[model samples]
Target: MNVAVIGGGGREHALARKLAQSDRIETVYAIPGNDGMRDVAEVVPEIGETDFEKIAALCTSKQVAWVVVGPEAPLSEGIADYLEGRGIKVFGPRKEEAKIESSKAFTKDIMEKYDIPTARYKAFTDYDAAYSYIESVGAPIVLKKDGLAAGKGVIVATDMDEALAGLDALMADSDAPIVIEEFLEGEEFSLMVLVNGDYTHSFEIIAQDHKRAFDNDEGPNTGGMGAYAPVRHIPESVRQEAVDQIVGPMARAMVSEGLDYFGVLYLGAIVTDKGVKTIEFNARFGDPEAQILLSLMEDDLVDVLEKVDRKEAFTLTFSPRYQVGVMLASAGYPGSYDKGHTIDFEAVREKSFVSGLKQENEGWVTAGGRVLLVTGEGETIESAIDSAYHNVDQVKFNEGEVFIRRDIGRHALK
Candidate 1:
């Protein structure tokens, strides 16, 4: 079977790599794929991910059996619905179901209606009204844009001045409503579940993502700095509680709300002293999180997604070894930075996933904020982390300094 994977990031690259491993799949094509994916999947550099007409034509021409979407933007824009309307098989949620990730206000309303555990939040359209709400709530607040902000739209402020400035910064250039939420203090973890509009569908192994750009969780938030699987910080009891009180309820609630959600549901939650509460929800597998999570999977990824598409019975299995993925970024990332730096892929020792590299006359150059993700697996978390960073240290970006967090998986190791 020939499958076409959408988007051209680390997540999409990881998905393409995993799906290509399936013996059931004969070919895999990546739309606008990066330079590294040429090794495993055929690269189609002409069509854009959001080019619905072009994508449909490609599927028809290639006799593509299944179309797997990797990014959230195309899903929220109703690409799956468009393709399915033309009788094309897609493994993603419809537009209405994608509201769970597209609109923060909509997600908060759903949580409130279903009595799910979450933080106190208020949506505002007027600047004065939003400022008044912030004053009432005091410092250490979270300001989020109502629509998609690429994961950096959220601003965590420490004081009223910073809060107001953050809100102003978000409101300065856009008219979209902003959601002011009370900050939840706890350890954060990522729980990604596969579903076919069924509340009883099982979830994959729990993983944790480090969103902050630098080590010790002290820096601006980027797409993702690093990630690891089988998070030990989240106890078994808390994990079960999250599945019961959070993931299960949300899945059923989507059905009740008349939304057929059929894809990966990512639950970004925090284990507070009081209990487990949701921090945010993503409509698909996370970037660096997908890197380590998919690395540990023992089951064929294409078969799993196909089963979800067919609503057939299939279970997800994982290796017991701990997996760690550390991201290598261009200097001054999560901020303004330079690109087109030459990168040495030959120095890399183990499996490494490329994100922002394109072939140039000289060599592969850094083309995005996050350059690559080097992953390693071992019997112990400490050994995995050690191996991951050791391989990361081998790669070099000649034009500028490459920054990486040395403390990835440290919290779990401790």
Candidate 2:
């Protein structure tokens, strides 16, 4: 069987590698796949991920048995519906369901209606009203763009000036509604659940991503700097509380509303004083988190997806070792950065997943903000973190136009 994965990033790279591990899978095709995926998948650079018509054509031509949507943008645009209309099976949710991630207001309403634990928030389209509300609420408030901003739309303004500036910038960027809410203090973690609108499964392991671009959790938020799985400090009881209160209720509520939901449900939640409350919801897998979590999986990813699609219970397995992954980004990432600096991946090619690369006769060069993710595993999170950084040290970027956060797994520091 052949499978096609949509998206050209480190997350898709991890999905391709795992999908290729399935015995039933004959070939894995990465739609507009990056150069790093060539070893694991047939790169189809002629087509773009969000081009629904061309994606259907490629699926038909390649005889792709199943298509896994790796990113939220294509899913939000109803790639699942388009592909399914042409007799192809998709692993992501439909258009309406994808609104959970595409539009912050959509998910906020559902959370309020379902009595799910989340932050106290209000949505606004008028710029004046949003700014007024921010002033009324005061500082240490959270501001989010109603639509997708590649995970960087949120601003945790600490002062009144910062809040007003963030609101201005957000209002200027898009005409969409702005979400402002009271900041909830707690530790944040990523919980990615697999659901088919009926059955939902929460993994025993949970991963936490460092969103800030620099060490000590300072600097602006990037997509994700790094991540580690099986957050031992979180405790099993807290995870269960999250599933019972947030993940399970939301899935059932969507079903109650007659929305056909499927695929991964990424919960960006915080363990606050009031318990687990959702910060945001993403329709697909998290980037660096997927890189680490997928590595620990002992089961075939295809089988898991099939079971979820069938709405049957699945008992998945995992490696006992803790997994860690750190992203190597082009300098000045999560902002403006230089690219086309030559780099090498041969040393860590097997164990690392490369992204944002432009192949040339000389070698591959940096092509995107996040260049690649280097992962490592160990019996302990500390060792796992060490191993990942050790591999990262060997990689050399021409002109040294690269930046990496050193304290990726600091929370697990003993």
Candidate 3:
């Protein structure tokens, strides 16, 4: 089978790499792919997500059997709908369904309507009205832009003053509308589901991500610093409940609304004493997270996507082992940063547990602002983290600095 992956980022690179390993796959193509992906797949320069018509034409011309979208922007713009309309098999939610991620207000409204557990929120287009609401809602508030802002829109204000200030930044300064929500306190975890309308299959839970740019979770939000899979913090039972109550029902709700959601459903969840409530919903896969999550998946990714597109019942399996990834980024990331710098990963050493187990260096290259993802796999979260950081220490880049959360799997360790 020939596959075409859309988008040019570490997530797409990870997807392209995974697809290339499939025995059923004949050729893999990436539109505007980064330098790192050139090794695993043929990089096409002319085609991009914005050129939907040209991309569709290329899919037809190349005899591409499946199209996988890796980013939210194109999916929110309805690339999947366009491809499926042409009788092409594409993995992603339709535009109408994608509004769940494209518009924060829309997602909050849906959650309220369906009684899906989530933070209390109020949408505002007027600054005064928003500020008044924040004053009433009190301190430790959460502010979010109605539209996507490349994973940097949401702000957790530590006090009433900060909340008011955030409202000004999002509503007064920015062109997009704002959503002021009541901040909920708890441990956060990411849950992703592969869905075909009402049918859904869940993957292993992971808890590795640096939302803030600075260490110790202080500073502005970022796209993501790093991520890992088989999160130890979330118990298996709790993870399953989240899928059953949140992800499954949400997909079914979209289906009921005449939107056939066929792709990845990323749920940013908060585990509280009141059960799990959704922090946000992403129509596509999470970055860095996909890098580590997919690395540990034992099942064939291509087959899983095909089954979802066909709306057929299929069982997916995951390795019992845990996976961790540390992202090496340019000095200034999720902000103004340098690019085109040379990177080196040849010094990284790989470790293993089982006898006869051999390790492989996937090679290193500059692909995005966040240069590379160093991943490690092991039987336990502690072992996985140890291996991942060991490899991360060996990588070198010119004028580059990396930041990662120290408590990636702290909950699991407990």
Candidate 4:
């Protein structure tokens, strides 16, 4: 079967790479793909990520059997609805179900309704009320822009000053509401599950995502700096508890709510001394996590999804090796910094699932914030981290130092 992965980001690149490895798959295409995917996918550069009309037309013309939506934005924008409307099968949820990620308040509400454990939060469209709530609750609270911010809209305020500023910044826009939550302290790990609700079938794997832009968990949050799997710090019991207590309840909630979900569900949860609690939910595969975990999958991604669609009993397999990935971002990413650096991705493409590049003069240059990913495998988390960083340093970028958190997997060492 011919498959097309929509969206041109690291997640899409990783999806394209894995699908290309499938023997059951005849062809793989990446819609508006980047240079790193060139080895594996036919890059359809003319189509935009959300260009539904052209995507359906291209799918029809290309005889694309399945369209995999890689990023959340296109899913939130209803690409699945359009493609499915055109009689093309899609491996993603619809727009209404995509509210799982598109709106934080929506998820919070669902969690509340289902008695799912999560941080206590209040959604506010009124700036004064939000500011007052922060002042009343005190420091070390999480203030999130209720809408999508490319994973950067969160402000973990350590004090009243920062809290107010964060609220002001988020509420500066008219329609952007804010959600302030009581901070829950714990080590965070995310589990990605292919969920087709009806309580039918699901497959889950856990990964630890380093969100802080700088080392030692400092600096503001970006989409994610790096990731490794299976996470070593969080206990297997706690992770299982998350699946039974959190993941299960949420899936049942979707069914009861009359939402037919068929796609990836990223359950971002934290292991607290009290118990496992949800941090957030994403509608599709995560970028750095996808690059790492998918590389470890022993089964073809196409084959697994197909079995899930058929409601067949199947076990998703993973290599014994632990996989790690470190992101190389433009020097000033998650804020503002550099771009247009001439980079030769040839050296790292094989070991990486990269994005944020454009070909010019037969050379590549940084086009977005998070540029590339280098993945490495090992029997231990420490060796995996070592392997990933070692390969990342060899990437050919004709520019000054790039930003990377040196302490990505150090928690495992601790």
Candidate number with the higher lDDT (2 or 4) = 2
> In order, what is each prediction's RMSD in angstroms?
1.5, 1.1, 4.7, 1.4
Candidate 3 global lDDT: 0.76
The TM-scores of all predictions, comma-separated, are: 0.97, 0.98, 0.91, 0.97
Displacement of residue 328 (Cα, Å) in model 1 is 1.2
lDDT for 59 in candidate 1 is 90
On TM-score, who's better, 3 or 4? 4
Relative to the unseen true structure, what is the C-alpha lDDT of residue 375 in candidate 1, on a scale of 0 to 100? 86
TM-score of 3: 0.91
Ranking by lDDT: 2, 1, 4, 3
Best-matching candidate per TM-score: 2
Higher-scoring candidate on lDDT, 1 or 4: 1
RMSD of 4: 1.4
Candidate 3 clashing pairs, residues 3+ apart or interchain = 232-412, 233-412
Which model scores highest in lDDT?
2
Tens-place lDDT digits, model 2, residues 77-159: 99999999999999999899999999999899999999999999999999888878887889999899998888899998888
The residue-by-residue lDDT of candidate 1 on 337-377, one tens digit each, is 88888888766723888888788985788899998998877
Error of 1 at 275 (Å): 1.0
lDDT, candidate 2, at 376: 78
Model 4, range 51-137, lDDT digits (tens) per residue? Answer: 999999999998999999988888999999999999999999999999999999999999999999999999999877887788888
Candidate 4, residue 3: Cα displacement in angstroms equals 0.7
